[model samples]
Target chain A: MPIIVNLDVMMARRKMSLTELSERVGITMANLSILKTGKAKAVRLETLEAICRVLNCQPGDILEFVEE
Target chain B: MNIKSKLAGIIINVSSFVIITGYGYTLYPSGIHNWMYSYKETDSLNLPVSQYEALNDSILTMRNLKNGYGFDHDNGQFAYLGTQTSIACDTCSYTWFKNNTQTYNQNYIKLNAWGIKKELPYKFYVKNKQGYVRKAVPVKNSDSKFNIVDVPVKFRYNTMDDAILIPVSADGASLFDTGWLILWGLNMIGLLFLLYLFIRFSYDTSKGRLFTRKNVTRLKLIAVSVTVYPLSIILLNLLVRFVFRQYFSPEVVLKDMVWYNAYIVLLIGIVLSLLYGAYNRAQLLQEEQDLTV
Candidate 1:
């Protein structure tokens, strides 16, 4: 619960559409939307790696540790 | 599913249906069941007059002490048909006296007087081992045999108040004559409920709804029915024993209670509960997988 997803902020900074990122990362828009909306319970390392590679960002840029 | 789980489910379902159907067939008739439960002693009622008189004189006596209607030793120790009695001992008190009796509104007390009272006009059946008929008898000929066990019996007597009529050394008042009927009714209700729940579960499974919320609820319901049905019946049996102790012996009720018949349900309940847990976890995993990237 303390781990918060910041995928929307990174995507915004990259000025990329979810549809483009999904196509580049070989993941569905639904899964990308779930990650963006912070609804995903987990992210596979391969999926994270693909998203980082496609978005040109680190995993830390899309995921953040929140104390609360 | 492996062959074992599939086989287990099939066995439980089929066995339950078969047993429920078997109960329907076996318990619908009174004579057939009585014949099934019939003791080896077919000639128990062939006692001579002198021996019966001697037994009446020596042993303690229980009369037809009911005010309105009562069992002819079929329902309890006291009955309506004059003062009909079936068994002398306490152990077999629920034993059918197996004869006819007539109603009387007089207060009569004589241990050996049922011989004349048995010849009154009207007739009603009293069940048990052969005992004296103190009520009025209209047709004493061979035609009377047809009327036996055909009449519905009713019971009326306080469990505690009847204690005075029973001797301390006597075995006790008992009622096992119609216990099978109660057991049969309960089993039918339980089995029907089980069938209903199972049908829905099967429908969900057929639609590939396994590990869904609906399936989880179905599994839980089935498990609860399987577990609660037998337990409630046993509790009712125990309740009968406790509540009927004033008139009918608890031991006799316990002996005929349908506790053992539904034990298989409990075992199946355990299996379903385990399945429910697995299904619940599987459902959670499925949800997580769907939401996770």
Candidate 2:
């Protein structure tokens, strides 16, 4: 629960809509929405790698750990 | 049907046939020769005793046979003292009856026996109810008016015999009329349907359809049917007793442990229904997670 996904910020920075990013990343838009809304329980390393490659950002840029 | 369902179906059909056939035999046992004459005569009476001075006092009580037998002329009463245990003798010709009520209660004494004999030293089985049983050997007291008996405790519940048939009564042919048989058949049919539902549920689970809404609803209906089964039987029995108050009593109906066991089954059904509800919610959560990226 402490780990947050910052996929929306990265997507905005790259000027990419969720659908376009989903197409580029070969992942469903619904799943990308889940990642953006921080509802995903965990992200597989393979899925993380794909998202990072498509968005042109490091894993840390998309994922953040905020201490409670 | 798939293999799993096919196997389940075969077992279900075979078992259902067996059970229904067995029920039919019990329902119509008239073909058996002289089976209706198997009733034994038992006389039950409550006698009030006025004197009890010590622990070994020979309590004297008397009852009339005409009042005890009532209208049950067939006289089919019997008691298996200690069914599975050697503690009580099955063939001990000694004429004595065990106290049905605990001796600690001092006012009235209750007992059931075949016949009563008048004598100086009466043989009686003394029991402190629940667990304690002893044989009271009576002897003439010093005053010669009252008898004194020495009772040595024989067995406790822990050491009691395991395989004894307590009291078995055969409801004579006259007792099982057409109406009673019809009611019993209806109850049996309900049970058969319950078994069918159980088989279907098991077949579905074997097919990996455990968390489907169909299964959830099925389980709920099963729960309700089982819960209602015992309740409906008890209600019917109560109604019969009410209508035939002259012939029936609560003691007669409540003696069967099957009624209480049905309630236990009802409780189990209710618990399963609750678990099914929890599983349904978890199933929905899993479905949502499956669709998520």
Candidate 3:
């Protein structure tokens, strides 16, 4: 619960829509939506690598931690 | 899928559907009707043999004729026990005959047989109109007044070898009161509930809701209900055993092949409960999988 996913912020910075990102990242939009909406239980290392490569951002930029 | 596999799947599905429908149809009302109406009016009676003296005289005359014909009337003990377990079926047996008003509370009759004289040869006889019948029951060899001669049973219930609990009215007038409803009515209701649970299970399965919390709960309930079904049968027998002991007071012996039947259903229920546990774990895993991106 402390780990917050900030995938939508990175997508907005890259000016990419969820459908275009999902198609480019070779994953379903539903799964990408799950990650974007912070509903994903775990982010696979390969998936994070693909999303980082497509969005041209570090994993730290997409994922943030909050003490609450 | 391949054509062969598809065809086989269709065949299996069609056959299963037909079989289930056919089975349900056959079990609707008549199957239960037989169980409810198995006992007839003559099944229970106070005077098992009305004209004991007349029957004895007739047997003696026949024996005399047999002696003249150089045939021996073998005096043997017929150890045939009467099938009617409930001797208190009619109001006369308990209330009027016993002259007890309070006996109506424990109306069912449980009959127990003891002191079987094996030495007495069983005599088979063919009367003029009565056709074939047991010739004569041997009189009291000892001081005990009752002897079980024959038992003709048409019951799906347990082989209740105890006292009979008849349903009687308050004033000891009517034989059949609401006790039959307690037996047959409750059986019908239980059966309907089981059918409903099965339908719900099938509906949930068809809807692809197999590994859900509600399904697991339903499965648990189904298992418990199945287990309770057999247990209710045992409880009914035990209830009869308990109620039979209230008045006139006889030793109780509850032994029947059907009594052992509960163990089989109990084993099935245990298996279902284990399935319920497995399904719950599977549901948790499914939820986790769904949550993962």
What's the TM-score of each model vs. the native? 0.50, 0.36, 0.52
- Could you say which candidate leads in lDDT? 3
The lDDT, on a scale of 0 to 1, for candidate 2 is: 0.45
lDDT of 1 by residue, A1-68 (tens): 78889888888889988898899999988888888888889899999999899888898988899998
DockQ of each: 0.77, 0.19, 0.49
In model 3, which runs have C-alpha deviations exceeding 4 angstroms? B1-187, B203-209, B236-240, B248-250
Q: What C-alpha lDDT do the candidate models reach, one value each?
A: 0.48, 0.45, 0.49
How far off is residue B75 in model 2, in Å? Answer: 20
Rank by lDDT, highest first.
3, 1, 2
Q: Chain A TM-score of model 2 versus the true structure? A: 0.95
Best by DockQ: 1
Off by over 4 Å in 1: B1-197, B250-253
Reference-based lDDT, residue B73, model 2? 21
lDDT of 1 by residue, B1-293 (tens): 79965654454343333432344344334442222121112224354566434333222122232222123232322111112232232222111222334322221111110111123222222235221222322456765443322222233222212211111211222123234445556667867876877788788889987778877877887877777766775665445445435533211223211344556768887888899889889999888888878
lDDT by residue for model 2 (B1-293), tens:
58954554454343333332343234223432121111111111121232111111211111111012111122221121111111222221111223332111111101121111222122223222322122223445544344322233222121111111121223323243334456557767877877887788899989987776677677777777767766765565455345434532111223334445666977987887787778779667766666455
Ranking of models by DockQ: 1, 3, 2
